[model samples]
Target: MFTRRGFVKLLGGGFFGAMALGGYAFGVEPLARLSVARYVLTPSRWPSGLKLRIVALADIHACEPWMSTRRITSICERANALGGDVTVLLGDYAAGMNLVTRYVHSNEWSKALATLKAPLGVHAIMGNHDWWEDRTAQKNGGGETFGHRALAEAGIEVYSNRAVRLEKDGSGFWLAGLEDQLALLPGRKWKRASMGGLDDLDGTLAQVTDEAPVILLAHEPDIFPKVPPRVALTLSGHTHGGQVRFAGHSPVVPSRFGDRYAYGHIVEYDRNLIVSGGLGCSIAPIRFGVPPEIVVVDIG
Candidate 1:
């Protein structure tokens, strides 16, 4: 059943198909396409007359080769143009994941992000990459600081297992950033370890009562199930909108919950969760149906 001509044709056809698919993934898919995923959520405890517009930026892995300073600046400009009462950045601001080629310093990118302006202001939280910096702090020293330092320089408050009351015109809600639990898992070897994991979910929620509308900033959506009922909303990244999807279905997702919490808005236990399709690429720099986007949520 095998012939020399038949085998050659089969091989040639397979090669062409592979090239075409790879070309699309590497060339056409990575272009920055912005879209606004809007959601209207009214928390039972939301203060009357207090309208909050929330913008979430996640997984902006501003690596040197992939994400340059000028590009990061442009990203901030686009985010600012959208206009939100408060802007939040979910972590992984480092240059790259898995292997590093050209490293993008956090401070420089944070300065670019500082340009993002809003009346309520901008906030951020650390991802696993930030925690990796802490793991290598002894060798890298201050240079390893990723998430908090840069954002702080840009007048953005970095939330780590803490709660802050953001007030606007005498009305506001409690916005909190939970620590990266994955980064701090104990007994984890080789670049993935934490001295003391301080997620402190209970302590973080202690400041907010049952009657307060709480918006949570978490890098991973795995925390969704653990979140108490007080938190009306959870904004997260690190999913990268699955980065690759076929027919709106992603075969591989970096979540313990699988497709249950992969991307987009998920309403579970009466809590609304929004996971963004981030600005930059990670692991392997290829994306399919899932394009990079900025999410704007309006809630009153």
Candidate 2:
């Protein structure tokens, strides 16, 4: 009953739809949710009083289809399974200003995130995306007002640029966070109080006793060089390991330093920097070579 041209068009449309669905089912959908853990052991001259196993999850740009309640629950379940003493969320918990409103307006997301538990409790910092994107008011002026409140209610402390101390086994470490360097962009002036000065390593160290190991958490890996030598280890997750790496190369990274600040462990002088690939996508929703990561750092 159909014309030859119409029949061909129908067949072509069906074929394309099948291919699209197949691709998602076999490729993108599977990658939409994944968990990877990288382990590191830190040996220090100080007494090995605490075998602190901290799990770091960062950049969960939570949005529909890609980042959802199921995905978050999966991440939490996996982290709990790892049995980490402390869980640290590096930043960029929401996708962006617009998407966050679409998702985080209700309390469901926050309540789900609250389920994540750690013996030492969970600590967090704000990523550039959170400050620049999520906080931007749209035409409606309805921005992250509720989302920020939700995160706070969920018991996740959002450190703009501050430090908190954690004590265990008679020893303690300093955990400091800084405002996003991207705040350096035009129109968004980062408060001096929120942009902790890394130029004075000795000054920052003065705040904490040398006996306790210090761990600094910054959202971007570009801040690595600025960190003080006194910081035993620094955890970050902005680069996303070049979300779409290819053939031993990460072609796309958000850093100005390019591959120099790509991913993995980098040690310079006495400072150690661990750049996590992160657990979510940004800019582009597809990930090729880069895989989501959950980092575990064992400091003894």
Candidate 3:
């Protein structure tokens, strides 16, 4: 029932709409948006009277003009105001994409992060990018990377397949961190055809000598299925909510589980996982429906 002129107008409108959407995704969301995604849960088997507040920052991917040191300091200030019992850095602090004006060095970014304050102190774990981007560490087949050293010098504890027991008001719980799941990439120097990881889930959990409920920090949510019931909650951020979610789904997800572990609160078999959309771009500087976020988890 449309005339030729109307048809042409419809085509032109659609073209401009697509261009507008692309512009917003590329130029606006990833650069200017920061949101808070919060989750409050009483996980099965979590102790009744022990309440904990955890503030988490993940996938920083620091670079000039995108995630500058000034911006990171502002983010840290905001996190401190949240008054979490503990602060956790979920890694990927290095630049994740080539479309950057300049990469923010580890020292600059770590120094900015040093301003964060929490009662239980700040704990960290490395992400795949933290491992993959460190050429010397990759070549050495698991030695200290600049990322680890920078974070350590900044007074943050970087956990690598390790566990630590923390106490709050006469109650204690364990914080376990797993190594990056995609730590090793295939190359001639490595002499491997497939990607391998340094993550040690079972070994890390075995460090628990008592019946304290545990909270696990992993870079990627793909490990959720393998997480045992002993862990009251699991936190991760690598997927970035697919970085460009649309219609309640991301067209392309970096995870092996596709959109299954893409973002937000996921509970399976009484094991809870919260995946943050994160605070920087990866592969490309683009974001649409899913904006950058700082995740807060309150658990009992």
Candidate 4:
């Protein structure tokens, strides 16, 4: 029922809309937008008097133009201003993708991250990219990766299948960090069998001698199903909110559960999990709908 002129106009409009969307996704959102995704929660077991403000930064994926040392420093400065009792670095410090003008060296990015300050101190964990990119670690098959050493050298405490007890205002809690769920790369030189991971949830949780509310720092949210109720909260980042979210849905999540744990606060059966959209891109240098975020969690 449409005329030839109307058909041509519709085609032209669609073309321009597509161009605009592409420009925003590739040029603007990824490079310019920064947001603070804040969440305040009180888990059932968390002590009422013990309030903790946790400032968390995830998936640095350090690279030039997209995520430089200067940019990381700026992000840290903003995080410090938030005045958190503790700060946790949810991994992926290595360059997530090959698309980069210049890859930001590990030392450089770690030095920049050293500026971040919190009362309880800064804690970090390894992400899949951190393990996959470390050729020496991959080749060695077992040992401290360059990312771990870099973070340690920077004075940040890097935990892998480790748990530490922290006290705030005479109240204590456990901060447990797990090794990456995708620690081993199968296609690489060292091929034992299938894709195995270094993550040890049982071992990590076993170290929690006391019943203080445990806050688990895991790089990927895929391990959420196995997490027991002993953990009051689990923090993760690795999906990058699919790196192109729309209408609260991510078309392609790196997680086995798809959009279930892609981003934001999720609770199932009284178990709480918060997956940050994170500060860098992965696989591709583009972001839309879900902007880079510095997650602030105030919980008790």
Candidate 5:
């Protein structure tokens, strides 16, 4: 029942539709939603009367065309207003590749974060890009500083393969963080790809005691499977919600575990995993289906 003219029209329409979708995914949608996804974590060990508000920012690639230092400062101000007990940054503060070159100084970004208000304190960890990008090379002429010093200088305690205790209303739990998992790149020696050095889960976990509850921060979500169930929760970022979602499914997830560990919260066996979509883009400046986000998780 179709005529030649009708078929041509159909093809033309389909082409335009594809173009429109691409525009939405790459340009329009990426900027449209600074979505906030919230979750409630009820750990049995956590007393009911007390609650912890955690504001997590991930993959904040602080450079031009995407996120500048000014933009990051705005994000920090917004996070401060949220009135969280703790603030955590999951890394990737600077872009690894050239989307734009006028990269914001890491130290400046940290100073902006210094103004963030959290009674429990603001903590950070590095992503693979932070190491491989060589942001710390200029300081020690390429020794392993990672980007920890910048954040730390801004008063944000940057932890790698270490544990620290956070007290809330006289009850405290051990909060731990790990170095990036795929830390060692193919041609590197004695270093993680971040080149800030290595990831030592065993070393970090050994510092924690069995009596207190533990929440571990590991940047890459794929490491969740390796985390012990005894740890109450593992918070991570790096997937960027697969960076683009179509029909509610994202095809670009970079995890070794596929989309299974891609984004948001997941539970396998008795262990829990929380993977954030994070806040910025990596290589491509355009995002189609996925909108940038800041995750606010409540734990009690």
Candidate 6:
């Protein structure tokens, strides 16, 4: 015979344990379904200059139970359908440091990513997970790392603290990307080392002129306030938009600024920031309120 209090305590513990196990199962299983959605962001600066269509995809933590080759290929097909002038992948391509080797060996996965096509081309940057997994030694023998080289081989330009100039008609704009700030943590050797200082935009923007607007692509939205004024627009996707958002409010967004830049479009000062909800799951794999997204920005 147990007291009421003791019975309640035992039931609560059991329920929590079941939830934890369920979460683990969700994370380690492959849910290879695809959904396509688009967003239109009109920047204030160039209101009627270039009609730039940008498709942004981020945080596809492809691992044991999250994503698969079929899913990636499906996403690529949808992106192509959007017919955006440029396709920007905001990082976290792999699940974690330990899963890098497994993904590299999966030829089907690599080929699926390689099949992603865009007229202007696809550009990407490294995320924390990418650095963590790629920079670690595999339990299985063989020296292989994940970073720009892998994406490059697949025809996706990896921009780590670098910028590329895109020209349309007679006008051109700058596209800049930074290495994951999380890589700077102690005891980790990032595959693509980031240039120190969050305020260090001059080095990345050296090639760009004041004539055209600058679009900055950083993996995490935490660097929003740090980005230079020269950048007219910034795109990020690390928070997963609280992945499991409530009906009217988002859960605790793990960032220094709380829910200030949790998800969706936000205007800060003169810079326009768009934080995508991302396409896949991680940590606790189940996404309740926040579904995956593919943001489409039509710059006119």
Q: Point to the candidate with the largest lDDT.
A: 4
What's model 1's lDDT at 2?
A: 95
Indicate whether candidate 1 or candidate 3 has the larger lDDT: 3
Residue-pair clashes, model 6: 3
Error of 2 at 213 (Å): 0.8
Per-residue CA lDDT of candidate 6, range 33-133, in tens? 44455556666677366888898898877754356666777777887788888899998877742433245333455567777777788888777666556
lDDT tens per residue, model 5, 116-215:
7788888888878777667344333333454777777777888888899878887788889887765444434443344234678789999986567888
Q: What TM-score does prediction 4 earn?
A: 0.98
Instruction: Show where candidate 5 strays beyond 4 Å.
Output: 135-143, 189-197
Tell me which of candidates 2 and 5 scores higher on TM-score: 5
TM-score of every model versus the real structure: 0.86, 0.78, 0.98, 0.98, 0.90, 0.79
How does model 4 fare in lDDT? Answer: 0.94
Model 4: weakest 10-residue lDDT segment is: 187-196
By summed lDDT, the worst window of 10 consecutive residues in model 1 runs over 137-146
lDDT of 1: 0.77
> Between prediction 4 and prediction 5, which has the larger lDDT?
4
Instruction: State, as a TM-score between 0 and 1, how close model 6 is to the true structure.
Output: 0.79
Name the Cα RMSD for model 5: 2.9
Q: Is candidate 1 or candidate 2 better by TM-score?
A: 1
Model 2 CA deviation exceeding 4 Å by range: 1-30, 96-106, 135-148, 188-206
What overall lDDT goes with each candidate model? 0.77, 0.69, 0.92, 0.94, 0.77, 0.72
